[model samples]
Target: MRTAICDMLGIELPLLAFSHCRDVVAAVTNAGGFGVLGAVTHTPEQLEHELAWIDEQVGGKPYGVDIIVPEKYEGQGEALSLDDLAARIPPEHHAFVDRLLREHGIDTTDRAELAGRGMNISDRIGERLLDVVFRHPVKLVANALGVPPRYMIDRARAEGVSVAALVGAKEHALRQVEAGVDILVAQGTEAGGHCGEVTTMVLVPEVVEAVKDVREVPVLAAGGIVTGRQMAAAIALGAAGAWTGSVWLTTEEAETAPYTVRKMVAATSRDTVRSRGRTGKPSRQLASAWTRAWDGPDSPGTLPLPLQSLVSEPALRHLDTLAEKGDRGAQELATYWVGQGVGLMNRVRPAKDVVYEIAEDFAEAAERLTGAIGD
Candidate 1:
């Protein structure tokens, strides 16, 4: 459990669990591992409330926050209102979604209210979120999309918070290190959410070697790492530790919809696909009718970042509600961000138990490795 990340983040274990659920964040931190709350979906007001609640639960344990501020996207430098952004989405895209929903036997009629429901991912919003984050006791701040914006790194450094950025390519890792990131999460395509084409086994060592000359920046291997044995493997591959996300989706404290959880449990390594249907980028999720329609041959194609987000979230939100109510079609079209590791996540356990198990498993794997050195 002793590693650079453990010391840097001030935790007993190097296992870092990323979850959107506040309960999971507090539970993992309290159990010894670090928890990073996903804040891209939360508004400033909501983030303040969520952070305050986590502050009360963890009793001073260190934690982190993840925000998506892509380095390049539609309307990056533009000042557009939510209405202005929504207006850019063409009618064909909406019609395509409506047809897809209807094919699944759900009603998408007169749903104009769903139009501006997408999460905003602009510089202005990211700066506002950073302001909220700095006001709290967050020890680490992570960006998953691209290099942490210059202001983000500067502000985090000013506030004495470690800046962590997730990169899939060795080139991206170099960029983050050059940009002064305190830590690097070398994520692979097996990871949930937005990811690149590299595999973890290759990317970890590649990134570690790529940045050694620059400085001794710690790298956490991410993508489909669910078990302590996998965490041990990541360390063997030259990672300081493991950064995990999908594994926590099935934990008891997760807020994943009941039906989607069932689909995930029944899934295997081959069940997920890297489709851009969700956020207009290739994110790994359980393949469903929604993903297939957008990635299919006769489709109009996906939109750019936040613009594509506007079209998808509203419709998916509606389907999720019906899926919870036993609408079989909705369930068939239901999907959530997950990785190939879903095959091993067949059981649901408390977040604390999951954290303890990973730590214990890591120790056992380390002993086994040591024993191999002799005899």
Candidate 2:
């Protein structure tokens, strides 16, 4: 627990739990680990309200925020709203989605009404989220998709808030370090959302070696890292901590869609597949009919970032609802972004209990390693 990440975040444990649920965030923080709230989906006003609620619950424990500001996304600077993006989605793609849904015996009626109701990815929106975060007492801010924007880096530095960024490769980590990120989340392809095809064991040390001297930023090994021994391995390879997301989805307080959580609990490491059906980027999700469609040869290629997300958002929402109703095909296509670590997550536990479990595993692993050296 005396790792650099613990020192940097002012937490007793270096385990970082990322969740969209306020209860999960507060519980992890109060349990002596850092909890980072995913802020990409929340509007600025909603984030402000959620952060305020978290502040009241955690009683001043340190926490962080994560936003998805993809360095290269559709409508990057166009100032497009969700409606604008929805309009840009080609009619061909829409037709294809409709055909697929109906062919699979799923409903498509709600897709039209929900078309443009979600968050629109843009530099402006990300900056707005940053402004809301800076107004509060956040300890850290992370860019989930790419290097922290220069403006974000400048703002966080000015406010003394540490900035972290996720990278899927060694080169990406170097880019983040050069851009002034305070921490490197070396995420592997096995990660759930918008990831590249590199396993954690290979990616972590590669990133550590790439940035250790050029920048002394702490590296957190992520992707398929589910157990304390895995976290220990990352530390032994020079990482400062572990960045985890999927393991927290099953936590009692997680805000993951209910049906998706049920599927996650029953999933195996092999149950996931990487496809561009969700966010227009290759993200790992539970293998389902949805991913299978994109992976199939007869399917049309995926659209770019926001465009693809726009086209699929309604379908995904409907799938979840229908899947919960025992619709077999909907359930077959019902999945969410989660890492390969699903196999290790068997039961639902409290967020606080998860924090303790990680700490206990880390301690036990360290003790065993030390004893082995003595032996």
TM-score of each: 0.98, 0.96
- Model 1 lDDT per residue over 31-115, tens place: 9999999998888899999999999999889999998888887877887777778888999998898888888888777676455
- Ten-residue stretch with the least lDDT total in model 1: 108-117
Candidate 1, which segments miss by more than 4 Å at Cα?
A: 110-116
What is candidate 2's lDDT per residue for 302-337, written digit by digit as tens?
A: 888778877777678877778788888877777888
User: How many angstroms is residue 155 displaced in model 1 relative to the true structure, after the best TM-score fit?
Assistant: 0.8
Predicted structure 2, TM vs. truth: 0.96
Best model per TM-score: 1
For candidate 2, the clash count comes to: 0
Q: Give the TM-score of candidate 1.
A: 0.98
Model 1, residue pairs in steric clash: none
Model 1 residue 253 CA deviation (Å) reads 0.9
